[model samples]
Target: MNIEWSALGSVIIWGILIGAGLPALFALGVKTLAVPAGPDGERHPSLGRRVGAWTCFGVIILAIVGAVAFIASGGH
Candidate 1:
């Protein structure tokens, strides 16, 4: 049996990236929302942080949707 080392390596790289990167991205979003924005340490985060966090979450949602679509297409 012949093993395609390059293809296997690519699969491994993508797997690790998607598996770890998404969660880390989520954590970053959470941190952005949770951290204080002003010197007075206000309860609500700033507008920029809110926008950034939402953008991160949106990207995650898009990734999930894309993956489901790909799988439904039988990995065309």
Candidate 2:
């Protein structure tokens, strides 16, 4: 069969975005959640940390959506 470049491009782009974006987002989140110790030597996640975690969770949701779409697209 003849090769299809546009389909290949779509698959490649989606794979790259999903593969790289998710991990980068998660790492950024983990870094933010890592709170430095105060004089009490206790670390706590601030509101920003919670929000970042939620944002990463949202990214995970988006990734799952993308996966569903990709599979439905029949890329394989």
Candidate 3:
């Protein structure tokens, strides 16, 4: 019946940062990598490819951080 507000806040913040923030960043990366024709509607680089690369990078970083945190937390 007891709740730890600090732990709850940490979880919420990490969830938001990983869940929404990573996707948003990936979107930004994709947008930046996209090539647009001058008023001709031509496109290159492919949004999907860019998004994948961004997501992979984000996931790697998250995994490393998570691993370090887990080790530091004594796996508790």
The C-alpha lDDT values of all candidates are 0.90, 0.85, 0.75
Q: lDDT by residue for model 1 over 1-76, one digit each (tens)? A: 9999999999899988988899999998998899755777675888999999998899899999999999999996
Better of 2 and 3 by lDDT: 2
Return the TM-score for each candidate structure. Answer: 0.81, 0.67, 0.49
lDDT of 1 at 6: 96
Write the residue-wise lDDT of candidate 2 on 16-44 in tens digits: 88788788888888888888977888878
| Model 1: residue 75 alpha-carbon error in angstroms | 1.2
Could you report the Cα RMSD, in angstroms, for every candidate shown? 3.3, 3.3, 6.3
Clashes of 3: 0
Output the TM-score of candidate 2: 0.67
- 31: Cα error in model 3, Å: 0.5
* Candidate closer to the true structure by lDDT (higher is better), 1 or 3: 1
- Per residue, candidate 3 scores C-alpha lDDT tens digits across 1-76 of 9899999999899989877777776667666666766476765566676676677677757877987999999996
Candidate 3's C-alpha lDDT?
A: 0.75
